[model samples]
Target: MQRPWVVATLFCLNAAAAGASPANLLPVAQKLPITPDNFCLGAQNVLKTAKQVLTDELAVLCTGNTATTLFKNLIAAPYAGTGTPALTQVFAPRADNNARTSEIMVAFAMRIPKTAVNTLLVEEKHAIVPYDSEAQPPPLGNQLANMKMSFQFMEPPKNEGDADTTFALQQTVDTRSVAVNFKDVSNHELRQYILHPDNFDFFMAGRTLVAPTEQFKKSVVVRGFMTDPADATKTLVVTVAHFLMNSRDQHEQLVLAFSNFLTTDVSKLYQEQIKP
Candidate 1:
């Protein structure tokens, strides 16, 4: 049965059945140490192709049972879209924010053909304006993408002890699987930001905020590369996992925005030249 609905009005996964794969396996224990410079750095790291990202300072999230469970989900059906592909996401079963931390993973089971990805260089200056840009005219993301992009403000969890919370620039469109706040770690460098796909390659200007929004935060790295496979098609795979604090109040609305941003705004951003 194909039913596209949100779980707890938080996650909207129109995904395929789950299965494990031998070819896509990685040695999780070999992950190295990586202390990113900023939140964007951390989020960007998570967005790398599975193999490159599986091992690193963030091994704790990718090792042991977590690694096994992740690969199984990754092996599911590939998302079949158009000249450009859309990500088919799978949610992890481990939903726990028991500690001051939470793990948030956005896994996409995809088979991107080398030809499918059309990388274009986009400007980054107007990528992220101040959070107060609401009063100003929205800037055009890219002439190619033709997107008048804007930013969203973030509200930290209210009940998680008083930490002098204020409005910080961040992205909504929540996959509120978990909530986390490194109240101890202060990376002030982590501010409002995003790198539109047009600024990179074959990708949608997924209008969703990439900065730390209502829940989780990290590097916002997303890409597709040619790989090795028997099929002459694209040979790249992607895996993303993250941790976010719990905020049901901000949950439903954020999720709805994320869905609308991707399906309505993002899906139409790029105009692909049909190859007949």
Candidate 2:
């Protein structure tokens, strides 16, 4: 996959340094770390702890007795508009601190079966408008063959008076399904759907007390794959890496904690799917 955003990041830095003022630079904000004592509620709690935050690489293994049924339910959830269980909002935002709140939403363009995915080249096509409005849209077959997934992040409002805010494009995922023959990990062959984020654009709301920058460099990637471990059972492995660019120490710790919480939630969801 071609990563144009990496080049764009370098160009943006150079342009900002040449013409931007001191006030335009990103500020150094306090980093919130998730410790044993401070770890509370769910993923939402982790995000609420700090205005400026990121996540770490997290992984989960979902086990089920029925492989086919489990895999079908997992992949069909988002496409069915039922939403991803892992990304659900766990806690309400603080009403007193409107400027520091953060929200996440995921949307899919279309739904297609795993067997139907062949020679598909899914890519992110950016535009000023939200949806494509071509005079003659692509055929249903072609559209189903390729897919693009969007992850949106809404920054807190600048003030308590503001209404609903627009969500910024946090990540664009190019998706494809491939068959993998496992040898070392497992003896069974598996079908894997890989999601790669080709671009990440996260902006900080100017209303926040400690605004880092209008836009911050972020790196995030997620993968979900399934394989049959036994005669009738299946195993699903979901791994995600989300973090701020050039961030370390406390900032890294906070994001890692948030990611861990999300991973746990995802695992629980998978377990529930297979229950009688």
Candidate 3:
């Protein structure tokens, strides 16, 4: 059964202490090895390494399990609302003291049935208006589907302000279910949704190998995928794994490692599939 909710208010004698509340960032963050010159370079390296580790980790996790799923490449797209697609070589997940933050990464994964996924395509548009807290903006685009969109800020669990935020895009399609979340802030209001029908063609084209590697500290793990290894016969099924970033270092490491691993001749990490 769905749980119910209640509204509560507490009167605190020490109002100053309550005023120090911090924004809740999700996942975790750690100290990362980064320098201006090597920021993007280091992120790519970390992404490559993390992909390998994730593969191994999945093999162990799925062992003795009958999930039998194919794995695909994890793609991080440019944020919809702000920041365009730009390539930067520097590698810190945290923004410099005085620079506009790099575009947020819209990481996605496509899973295929036993039949096979010939192509992968993901198309998302920028939200027309930012989400509003005081004022409830009308529902976004009204394209409800059985998909979900989730986001988590990279903050250490030890920090009082650390929590994973999730939202489901209420799309109209599929035999599956859908979920959504909404939020509003000063500069921009935001809403994230999962659309119906996983488009495989767009991703397999290899136009954009991976997300831009800027302000991506190697200390946090952005995300990973688990898929069946490509073979001559049959098809590969895949599942994407999401990891919480507790520190800037983890994020930096994941971007660098995943980028290098994806843009290589490595079959274990990623390979072209026969278009269906």
Candidate number achieving the greatest TM-score relative to the actual structure: 1
Model 1 lDDT on a 0 to 1 scale: 0.28
lDDT of each: 0.28, 0.25, 0.22
Alpha-carbon runs more than 4 Å astray in model 2: 1-87, 90-101, 105-111, 114-120, 124-212, 215-276
Tens digit of per-residue lDDT, candidate 2, span 147-203: 233333334223221211211233332323222111111010111112211111111
| Tens digit per residue, CA lDDT, model 1, 1-276 | 111221211111101101222113322322222111122233343345222222332332234213334433443454434533343344432334343333333544344443322211111222233221122222312111212234443442222211111123333221212331111111111111111211111121112223454344443323222222345334333334233433344443333333233333222322221111
In Å, residue 67's CA in model 2 sits off its true spot by: 12
lDDT of 3 by residue, 1-276 (tens): 011110010111012113422112111132222111222232233324231233332331132222222211222221112222222222233423233332122222323322221211111121111221112112221222222222222221121111111212221111121332222111111111111112111111101112223222211212222122342122222222222222222334333333332222122122232222
Order candidates by TM-score, high to low: 1, 2, 3
The superposed Cα distance between candidate 3 and the true structure at residue 189, in angstroms, equals 31
* lDDT measured at residue 272 in model 3 versus the true structure, 0 to 100: 31
The worst-scoring run of ten residues by lDDT in candidate 2 lies at: 181-190
